[model samples]
Target: MNLRQLIDASEGVVKADRVITGGTLVNVCTGEVYPADVAITGDRIAATGDVTAYIGEHTEIVDATGKHLVPGLIDGHLHLECSKLSPTMFADAVVRYGTTSVISGLDQILVVAGVDGVREALREAEQSPMKIFWGAPFKTPYTLPETTVGFNFGPAEHEETQDWADCYGVWETVAEFVLNRDPDVLRALELAHRNRLPVFGCAPMASSTTINALSAAGIRLDHESYTAEEALEKLRAGMYLLIRESSVAHFLNENVKTVTKFGAQSRRVGFCTDDMHVADILREGHLDKLVRMAIQAGVKPIEAIQMATVNCAEMYRIDHLVGSITPGRYADVLIIDSPESFQVERVFSRGVLAAENGRTVTAPAAPERSAALSPAFQVPELAASAIGIAAAGDSAEVLVVEMDRTVPFVRTRLDLTLPVKGGVVRADVAQDALYCTVSERYGKTGATATAMINGFGLRSGAIASSAAPDDNNIVCVGANREDMALAVNHLAAAGGGQIVVENGEIKEFLPLPVAGIVADIVPEEMAAAEDRLEAAARALGCELPSAFGYLIFLEITAIPDYAVTDLGVISYHTQSVVDTVLTSR
Candidate 1:
């Protein structure tokens, strides 16, 4: 690992352990592509030039003669926990697709088990082939009040910055800034700043005034812009832009257009998949998909690779070890047959043959520690009659959350008159409205709020998920209250997971033992289970785009206008629970 030895190897003074001769090396650092020989010693690239003398006895030569050698891909931000698989299984799914590293928003761990849970997950992430970096989550219940399911952690749970940045090799606190000049957020920013950590951003639909304030608060990069104009404005405001393409949002193509419009201003623009599901990754791809999307948007292949590799490493200040194929850098290389298509044929992570022929050659690392049970996963007992909604009289009026198909994140509150029977409100199938409920999962309050939601078009049946974002409460949408209770009860009894029930029978189920959020299964199995659940929802006459993903967001309060929580339905503007009944109507 000495510089003198590497220099000697470059001059044929020493033998290299491995020599990859005659490959078109992609020099992302200089934006150059040329034919060269790369010499590797151990896990570091010893030299990258004509290395005719470096070949000797015991030198392993990788025949890359006509193939393209590029740095392994890097994802700017992700949530492996949400992939519904353990860290080991998640790696097997993405490494074959050529992803070498990622920055994970560990907020999922915080939400399920607080900071202690985060520490445990970080320990397990070390066994993964894909280098996982940590990001300090700013949206815990302490920061965002609606994140409460009565699971509160004091400042003691906040692991010191050194524990994350040094021991766990974390990058920084991601996607946060003061909301309405909140003092707690300001205090959190000061803490991060004191530790010399860079803060990433998440500011969607922010006006000039808010953007300026965010910039001044040191949130330097954003991946939330949905349009080219919005991305350009963020860059103009001295913030880096991450063109995102996730399971729910696809902004890579539009942001590439923004990069083209910038001409020279494209340096600050990059790529990321802030949130993606395992089914989508198994079907489409990982970071590789975003790269292909960029190429389709008229972006040069090398430029897109830069955004996926170097740009992200530079943003996190980890370029010294990764993001390039140069001396002193980890030999994380991808062998592709062509530059035009960027088809990754073979992969190497840290000089290990991690994947070959679209499959991982390296087996998953052994489980370092047993899975710690998160108390948040505990659920209270409930009956089929517990979720019932009592009505004042016949033909009562109520406000329903209307779901919009074809386009996501749009809904209109409709005043609906429903017939009452047995002193309870009933669902109206003719109007495509169903009863949706969010029940407390931590067992603090056996509270359940039932209301009508339009959009699922469920003819008859119920679907329940404990994968609710932020709080991980049980959210169920169904055409019948009895079936809704059955689905929710099933999910609770299984610890925590997703379930689809129809005609008093269970159709699809996937158990998630990790805080009732992540499953102890491989990506293939997880994807298959999710696919079956989607098909089951469709079979039950529920017509909505990807019912699995669409309904999970029902309890997400981070999104727009209206969202349901265990406490009640929340209005983002008022930051309080909105009434379910239309008294005036």
Candidate 2:
């Protein structure tokens, strides 16, 4: 921990505490690979490439004769709540895959628990080996008139983050607000610029004019570019691009082409798992999976590794503390089989062995549960009558939100006619259309809106979740009113979580007690619980790969086409509420 000792150790005047010998060093800083040795003193890398003079009898030697030493991967942008695991458990899951650090937005937690909740989650992350940095989420409710939230994050909250040590920058500056030059958003941007913090961007499918406005407003990085051309435009416009590969979204293959076709030197790009599931992390790996996918897409192995390491660190201006194996860094390194296979054999965090051979060796203790994070669902008791759609006549033509079978988040508005029984319209299962609802649960408003959706593929059952992104409101979809009421009430009674109900019985449930978004459990248990929920959905004739995963996107207003919120169905194209029922006859 002493600066003088580190300098002396680097100069060979003091013996290193640990020395890794006989390994090929993958220098990300210089993009070169060669045989070298790494010497570590305390939690800092003392020297690299032949530490013969620094090694002493007391030094612990690690054998890596055929392995390559590379910098531990860093995820530039992520939403930890999307994993459904607590911060400590999420770290435990990804650390084995060589992801030693991550930068996340507190938007999910901020909506439910406010600023205090954000601080509480950050404190919990400190106990883990994975270094977690946060960006101050300036937009909470996302948009007015479409959704509701517990807290409204603005310029005042941005100013408060200036004093928080781990606060990195403004998170996900929305493109629409910048293009419109919204006064509050501009004030927040000004505050971030005055503090010298980089503004993270979210401008998917943006036009040249919008990109220009965003750049002129000081937004520096973006992760929503879906195509190679989009990525090139953002890079040419002087914005750092984060190639993303999430559980539901797969944009890595298309975006990595920017590096493969246009060369890697001029483009500032990195990797991010914007919103990944724990099951995906356990089965396919984390950022390491992204690195491999990039290689498969024709990107050079070293360039792909650079995107996962130094590029992310430099984007956040944390290169001095991490992102490389050089001296003066945090000694976070990975021992991989080779660049082609990209197999991680060992992981070192802060000069200590944290994981080996796809397992954690030094799992940190779980942080104590915070009382403030306890779920506080305040919605009124619901009945089947409360969720039914009343019809003006025997039959009615309604506007339905159709989920794209391939991409669940991509929706389309469809007009269809349905029969009415007892003056109430019911879900037409034969047509593959089901009723969907979003209920406000933050105690501010007890509002709930119902709409019809297609492509869920459920023949008989209902699914609901309180972990819906952006607004964090309760979203449910079902074929019948009874099962829908059962699922919604079950989540309310259990504080908050996800549930699948069939025939008025709870088939499967996973409790997310932490602000109704994350569960305080280990990765294995969380994955198992999610697996059971998916299986339950399948048993009821649901068709999606992950029905619960698809259910959570119903309330997300950022996506295109249509989104169902507590207020009503929002038409993204029109930017206003649309009639769910088109005509009655």
Candidate 3:
């Protein structure tokens, strides 16, 4: 602050840069509302009171009469890459929804592209409207030896996170801990702590024993609670619950019962959209929609706003700089007509008008990003013979994954008999079984594995993607190997992307050439392609949740029950490669 200028403004000798007058300020810090005026000088708030005495000819004024002025909404946790839109496009989509800050999990791109990937993500963040922070990934076991991904962390990239990121804090999952636990995970946690970063835990469906172990290990919070029982357990274990309302994980309804269970201690709860797609965010909303859901579930509006703002900012350790409308902080304020209607008329960021009437006033200009940051794909070639299934007998018993249409994460393990011809086993679509294959993209290993899959509901046609979770590789499932090969090759030719093929022809496709994780396109373009893909998927009789995203996790090693990788099918209970032929091994 300029002492002379501050004194002059106090004495009505100089004018404040901007002012929002005649508003009921929702003071998140004090849980109070008062009719006041907010004065902004440059990027920081200069005063919060009746500042008419400091009005001058050059001062800009915003009329907030009868509006509730609250601090900018902060999204506690998210993966911006999940939107499949570049950082610039993602920011444009959410700023109008009132999210001024975001904490992004770096696992997706980090696993796909490594240190350069992390750097590119940070580079994109600098151009975004929201204040974006990183959550450094602890991929641990998958970062080495058997079934490793493309991304490898070195000393140089590790140094970059020191100043701007937090720990992902997960040791993969409870399954990995029980079977593949390592010392490096603990070392990573300690490093994060030494830097004063909070180690956020990933304890989905963990037993009470595991939760206690994690708490003792210095993990401070969890967003993996899927039920009220789970939520209460984590909260009682001194873990703050994120109450996720993601595109895939719908835990907010079940977790919100904790407000009744803990009453005032509900302050320990906040909201997050761990991974949401563009269409969902565009149609339903973002953190603002999550807050509205909380209120509908019986949480008071002020407390809900508190969870979205102050409590979350405190968790990020940036409360002094944001999370509330106070002096010496960025002027991020929302003008709301009412909490019941949840209508936002205006949004201000850094004392500048950002959004009004459901649109951004100043959308980020689309730029040709630097080549170093905008990565390209380089997956190797594979012949149609590469994705074949071999059998020794006329009929073979094979271990297949059973999927449930409603719950995307949970899968059932099953052993089934399949027909064999010419010492080869093929997908039996009549039995609702489709042949699935996963291949190593980065290594171009040409190593591929195929298995019979159920509950994915694909009767015909094939889908291929390079965004296979955990260790992003090429994964495709189809009634015929020929179509599967076509889908895979289509994605390869596009550099990196998702593809749909039917009856020897291409159906729908969406390219994601940057890091094999995100598409450098606007949300509308991406969402439109997704719409066509879903239509084609439905026409082919596939019944997965969202055709665009759910199938990509077919190989996610971090989740439970059963998953597949280019290496082989992995049983989460054992965390080891399961025998494809049930009787052989």
Candidate 1 lDDT (Cα, whole model)?
0.74
**TM-score, prediction 1:** 0.92
Query: Quick one: how many clashes does candidate 3 have?
Result: 0
Error of 1 at 544 (Å): 2.5
**Winner of 1 and 2 under TM-score:** 2
TM-score of each: 0.92, 0.96, 0.92
Write down the lDDT of every candidate, Cα atoms only.
0.74, 0.85, 0.74
Candidate 3 collision pairs: none
List runs of model 1 lying over 4 Å from the truth: 1-15, 52-56, 142-144, 149-159, 166-177, 261-264, 365-376, 388-390, 410-412
Task: Give the per-residue lDDT of model 3 (tens digit) for 421-447.
Answer: 766676788777778888777654657
Return the lDDT, model 2, position 421: 77
What are the C-alpha RMSDs, in order, of all predicted structures? 2.9, 1.7, 3.0
Model 1 residue 369 distance off true place after TM-score fit, in angstroms? 5.2
Cα RMSD, model 3: 3.0
Query: What TM-score should be assigned to candidate 3?
Result: 0.92
Candidate 3: segments with Cα more than 4 A from true spot: 1-15, 140-146, 154-160, 163-181, 261-264, 372-376
Measured with C-alpha atoms, the lDDT of residue 449 in candidate 1 is: 81
**Between candidates 1 and 3, the lDDT winner:** 1
